[model samples]
Target: MQAIVVEQITKSYGAKGAVKALDGISLSVAKGELFGIIGPDGAGKTSLLRILATLILPDAGEAYLQNLHVVRDYKRLRSLLGYMPGRFSLYQDLSVQENLSFFAAVFGTRIEDNYDLIKDIYVQLEPFKNRRAGALSGGMKQKLALCCALIHKPEVLLLDEPGTGVDPVSRKEFWDMLQRLKSWGITILVSTPNMDEAELCDRVALLHNGRILAMDTPAGIRGSYERPLFAVRSDEMYRLIQDLRQWPGAYSCYAFGEYAHLALQQSLQGFDTQADSVMAELQQYLESRHHTGIEVLRAEPGVEDCFIASTKDR
Candidate 1:
């Protein structure tokens, strides 16, 4: 059974219909599956989550959580889903235990009644149980927020960029905790801007500018990349890009890390004379003009590389 189903979901804001936050987005999360929405800032991930959580209504389309209509049965839906918003929305003045208790109470439950559901996470906060949530570290606050969300034992979890603002170590630990949570048969739908985190999900949808570029497993997405790319770097970086772009056979070129990734227009041309012929001509042209320290090597495409390539195509 599908835990969550969104069909043709769309949202917009401003008087002139200025911003289109979500645009005809449709997706489904299977029961007990970990689905990810991978996108950068302002990609409408939060807007979609809010709609699913029944905190916001979509301008069009419909959504269901565990077969319950999000809009029609919002009151009942609230009792069956856990949501951790992008921002830390927990009360700062409340102690860790108090916040958990309050959220549990809201759903007609007590901390003790569901302590086993969150014991692994709650213990870490137990040492600071009496401390005000405002004074906790970024990682600790993340943990507390999650505990509160899970206190009611919801069937689905919606997390929006849960790793943002936390240290790398804490981010890794948080994802590890999510893996453990999956064994409990709770469906998880998480949104993140980090490319590395996208690999952890069972499947991911890459979003850009309120549109989905692709949706598939990490390996499957990577396997779809077909072009041969090269990383070219030089001490005279500006001149290298300028010269490379002007090269006759170059199809596309862009800066990546410390090197410029270049896609050639023609691949069959041998690098020895045809490809190297162009490079040597450019090198000599550069050397004649007093350029120095050029390096170019063939490189395999990574997730970031594929993302850039896909965006460029769009």
Candidate 2:
């Protein structure tokens, strides 16, 4: 069954609707699949997740959870949905175990009833079960939150920016747990501003400006870039950016980690967009300007590369 479905949903806020958080957004997820909504902050990822979890209604259009209308049957839908918002929202004074028990109680279930569902996660928190949630480290608190969200054995999980502030190792661990949950037949929809995290999903929707720029598997999105790309680096990074922008044949040059990925201009008069041709041109331009230790090689496009290209016009 389709686990979730959204149709042309739109949302706006502030007086006179000055802010449009979501714009004509529509998508779906299948049961037992891990789906990701990838975007940066203020891209409306949280708003879309909230609407799916039945926390708020859209200004236009509608959504569904497991075929149940989100607005009309929110009470029953809440029972079957697990939501971990971007923030650590558990009670500050409640101990890890107490918070777990409380959430289960609200769902008319007990820790013992859903022990298997959260055992792996809860085990890490077991030693710190007596510690107040606020006193725990960021990773630990995130784990506790995930445990609470799963206590009821919800069929679908909505996690918004769950890895935003956690460490790299903890981030990996949390995603590992999510894969295990998918194995248990739970539909997962995760949102994040991290471009690299797009690879973790079975499929992803690249969102920007409250709209979806592209939707496909990670490889599919990267493969959509229509120009030859290269990772170019010289002794001086800042000067390289300035020089590349003036090359006239350069399509886009943005710093990415230790190197800059440049998309050379397309096939136009006096310019050859072929990979080797563009590489040669870039090499000559940099060498003329006394650029030393120059390294220019073809770069395979990734999520970030595709995101920039997709958003170039929009």
Candidate 3:
């Protein structure tokens, strides 16, 4: 059986249910598979994770973790699930060791019972075992939270934006830890707004406006961009993007790091779109716009590129 299953789940908040958090969203995760829910803020990533964590019930449809229904079998499922919420929710006054011990006791387990499960992580926190959780660095706090969640050796882990507020190096370290945990047969469903992180997941679901825009491996998601893509940069970066967006043949144009990635429409009215001719014409057009230092090169589609195009298409 699949490790996690969600079918046609929906949620809304506010008076008369004016806000729709999820719109018939459905997906599943295989045993030990690392699945990602990728999207920006207000895209319902938190709501979806919360439902799976059994923090709240979905308005319609059903969800199951390890074949235990999220609603009906929440009590049973809780013992098998480890959740690290986006925000730090641990007791501020308690030291790291105290917090870990408290959570283990709550679950009726001793820290030694699952020492092997979290030893790799706790070593880093051991030096600061007496430091209050609230006083720890952002990254340390995340590590402590993760350690608490894993104290019971849950079969499935739900990490909600564990990278947020942490430094880039810490973020990388955290993901590496996750990769290690997956090897131990734990199903992981992590949610993040960082598009770059999507590549690390075995599969990802791109979500926006309370709905899934696309779901596939990172390579598969990039392959969905059927248009010709190019990276263009010039002396006037700001003006270059404006001109590219206004260009007649432009299908999608947006800033990407040092260059603005432009996806061209294959066919444009009275425009010769043959690759060679298109590149030459684009240069000529930018030159005419009084933009100097122009450089345009065909570019491969990245997860971020595909994300923007998908959002526009939807």
Best by lDDT: 3
Whole-model Cα lDDT of every candidate shown, in order: 0.86, 0.91, 0.93
Q: Model 2, which residues run further than 4 Å from truth?
A: 267-274
Candidate number with the higher lDDT (1 or 2): 2
What would the TM-score be for candidate 3 when compared with the true structure? Answer: 0.96
Candidate 2 on 119-235: residue-level lDDT in tens?
999899999999999999999989999999999999999999999899999999999999999989999999999999999999999999899999999989987878777898999
Look at candidate 3 and give me any clashing residue pairs. Answer: none
Clashing pairs in 1: none
Report the CA-based lDDT of candidate 1 relative to the real structure: 0.86
Candidate 3 weakest lDDT stretch, 10 residues: 265-274
lDDT of 1 by residue, 216-276 (tens): 8888887776666678888978778887787776777888879988776665335445655
TM-score each candidate: 0.88, 0.96, 0.96
Instruction: Report lDDT (Cα) of residue 32, candidate 2.
Output: 95
Could you tell me how far off, in angstroms, the CA of residue 81 lies in candidate 3 after the best superposition? 0.6
- 1 or 2, which is superior by TM-score? 2
